[model samples]
Target: MNSALTPDAVVAAERWTAHNYHPLPVVISEAEGAWVTDIDGNRYLDCLAGYSALNFGHRHPQLIAAAHAQLDRLTLTSRAFVHDQFAEFCHRLADLTGQDLVLPMNTGAEAVETAIKVARKWGYRVKGVKPGQAKIIVAADNFHGRTTTIVSFSTDPDAHDDYGPYTPGFQIVPYGNLSAIAEAIDQNTVAVLLEPIQGEAGVVVPPAGYLTGVSRLCSENDVLFLADEIQSGLGRTGETFAVDYEGVQPDMHILGKALGGGIVPVSAVAARRDVLGVLQPGQHGSTFGGNPLACAVGIEVIKLLEKGEYQQRSAELGQRLHAGLETLVGQGITALRGRGLWAGVDIDPAVMTGRRASEALMERGILAKDTHGATLRLAPPLVITADEIDYALDQLKAVLG
Candidate 1:
């Protein structure tokens, strides 16, 4: 597909840096499309896609070309001066997201942080909420980011405990439970932030009508529906966004991960003018946010999405993936859930732990990751072909047995 890496570049692959994969012992030296070659020359089919960060696969030609072109011209202005790529990046993103405005940031965490600030400001300025009384509702077992404020509302002990004293003004509700959300809302509630499908929580897809219900509840209570689509957006879930399955439009969108086409880091929050308009100059900003290089890569990402082929591949191949996974349920998998090319397989604990199974899969030349003890997550790059998908499934089946 993308011949971004020539033969010379492939041979020049660097050694793995230390500590990133501590104790895993897998030293990846190079990658192309849906496969990675370890330093010792072993190749593995990639199933995690760098936690969905590399949705377009490694070294996609278009994304790399944009990055190189931008490098030759301009890189940074620090938001102090306007650059040529700024408006075009933001404008295309706005149009893509079907929103009135967009505020760019450097990472998913930064985008979520921006949304939080915007929501709080909107609560006080526009919603007429009293100072220091605003609250945002979040789902349980959600992974927004590692920021102190984000982890403040995390239900996972690993992410929550010892990270305190935690921030306040947020409420936790059961994911996929509309009644719980309705019961938790109050006059001071500023927004309801959720992942359309919780990624870190073993790719948990909410119950039917869950997304639309949340949208309705937010509208009824005048609270902004903030969809943290960082992992679930950008055609990873077969649609532009996971929420599109229900045709629900969130008031604010928090996007990242694949937004930079797995090259540079680019994140943004898209919302109506009345919502993001609450922020004044100097209220909050990042020096590297919306930089020329990030924007150039982001524009290419948007253009690729506009083609609709990747999304179609995911949707079609996803059916093939799930169909294969479905046959393994009760044999080794306790449960299976996901959308598009993404899946969460719950290994039977009696057979082996998810970690051990992942190691077994790794040995079989299929790379994947385990989450929360017994659940294994698979989000292969969209560039992954049907044959590769079958090969991965065969390896997984052998591992489970």
Candidate 2:
């Protein structure tokens, strides 16, 4: 902004917005694969990849085609009426998640809220918990979404503060600590919700066997395990799901972000019939939950996942990414945490703040974002090649140097 007249789009956005997000001043106009071109016609490698929402990359040909075809046929029919594309996406998604049923929603936060409602109902009718006393345990530092209920359990001051009177019934526990979760679960507990890898918490991966222990503890306590895979899922973590690394399937799989294949906003909670089935017809519904356009794009997303190329690429290319990143440890980076194409890089505070590092990287033709105080979250599109990864690493090295 200081070097040039701030782009009109960026200026207008700042002039009209609520200032909720402090995004770096870069106005992207178009994108494909792993790159985006600004309105000024400068292309930068898209390192954030829309926080894993672009796992399949921007305007994926197949997904675009599906959206186009569906747009020509039908767009929104609401959940009141069933569209031809609805059941296909739901069924395929259920199959992919290996769940008995799938309930679609428009955003990840909606899916989380749906899961919370279903879990509470299940506790009342199925688990036989006291109607008003049903309790759920969540990890500290978890980022499910910014909804009021979800924010109630959020430990981050930015998301949690000013968002009260907070919802009750959620018990906070230390993430990755099986002992903490076990001690928190009581007879009135209905579920334990977690993100296998705490994406917003700087791609925080838990200790080994932590997920398995949580799964076992939930099973022993007759509690439902809800895994929020909205960010670390859909082939972003070098696996279909980060929990896949441990082969631990939660009772409910909360999915979104990449499920729309960067085409539309789509999300869903995949769970066995008994758990999600607790919702009565009038109890839960979304007008745009399973609309034709979303389902069409979602179906193509599932189809692309079924072939397994993206997951394989994440697994194989991830090594190259991390290996190069690891070399920067002492040079400027303090540490790294993540799996697959996703990473949370901690820049040495003595060297530079994450914001400064991000700006430096941006100036060098790479666009990565910062999270916490000094951590950078990088999730490049899965389609990025070896050379692109190397280029990003080289730029990062220069920025840190």
Candidate 3:
């Protein structure tokens, strides 16, 4: 075992906390860029990137500076009263997304809930859908969030089982099927909520032109296209938004994760004024939604994205990463799927389970996560270099061998 993999710490953590997460054995103490050091000072390359939350890398200098500067100033003020940092954050994010308004929230799930509320309200008020009859079509195998309403439509048994009585008014359709989405829509269908690229479902990218078709259908049917970009946005897929690759824009963009620059929890729903304006005063609000600290970190994140360097890096490096992973197919990898710096690799079940492959990689100083049965999800920080990518591939090859 690696010196950094502390058995005692892992045991203590499991004993103290709920069994909500089955984390790897290593105990990370500090992280910088795409690397982490455990308690024993053993280092490992971070391939998960906190599920794309660390797109700019851990403890980025500018993000840290913004956090520190905000610490000396202000933090929370709730939605009851406005704060100095609120407008700039909202405006810049709106500009970045090319939307008219923004509703800030603290987490990805909260933003999703906010979108649901806004969509339902818009359906009732604008689309003239009967109250309590507004329906939103969602994709199967989707991983929106763990909220009661969000998980109600989840096709995954692990996420759906025991989560209800479950919320209603959602229609489930197979992802990447435009015909299913079109067939599911009706007079009462308010929106089609989907992840442009299903992140947690092993970074599954939908069929080409599917998003464009969805956009056109939504426009024709007067239904909203709400894209949950929480995990796939912010330079992860080499674009500002995953839908951008298809030249498709959703009615509302639900954003999170990297929006906080890995410094704080920040998320928002960006949409046109008419769509989000359905919510009047007292309709929805959050205490820490647009707090100064979150805005500070978010502003820096937007600024970094505005430069377009990280997106370019993800595009260029992503090609190299995918090329390398592609060469591994039939050797140990059964399949590979993804874009930019994100990939879901299927290890041959004959060789080992995904969890076993992850453990082997961990022992080799590369940290990654396994999903499903034999699929590994790799999303390294955008700051990782070409040499680091080659090193990780070498380690993976050794583990599979």
For residue 339, give model 3's deviation from the true position in Å: 0.5
Candidate 3 lDDT over residue span 1-401, tens digit each: 46635988999999999998889899999999999999888899999999999999999999999999999999887888898999999999999999999999999999999999999999999999988999999999999899999899999898899978999999999999999998999999999999999988898999999999999999999999999999999899999899999988799999999999888999999999999999989889998999999999999999999999999999999999999999999999999999999999999999999999999999989999999878999999999999999999999999988
Model 3 lowest lDDT segment of ten: 1-10
lDDT per residue (tens digit) for residues 118-161 in model 1: 99999999999999999999999999998999999999998888
List model 2 lDDT by residue over 227-328, tens digit each. 999999999988899999999989999999999998899999999999988887889999999899999999999998999999999998899999999999
**Highest lDDT, which number?**
3
How displaced is residue 243 in candidate 2, in Å? Answer: 0.8
* RMSD (Å) per prediction: 4.4, 1.2, 0.9
Candidate 1's displacement at residue 215, Å, is 0.5
Return the TM-score for each candidate structure.
0.95, 0.98, 0.99
Global lDDT scores for all candidate models: 0.92, 0.93, 0.95
Worst 10-residue lDDT window, candidate 2 = 1-10
Candidate 2 TM-score versus the reference: 0.98
- Report clash pairs, candidate 1: none
Q: After superposition, how far is residue 229 of candidate 2 from its true place, in Å?
A: 0.1
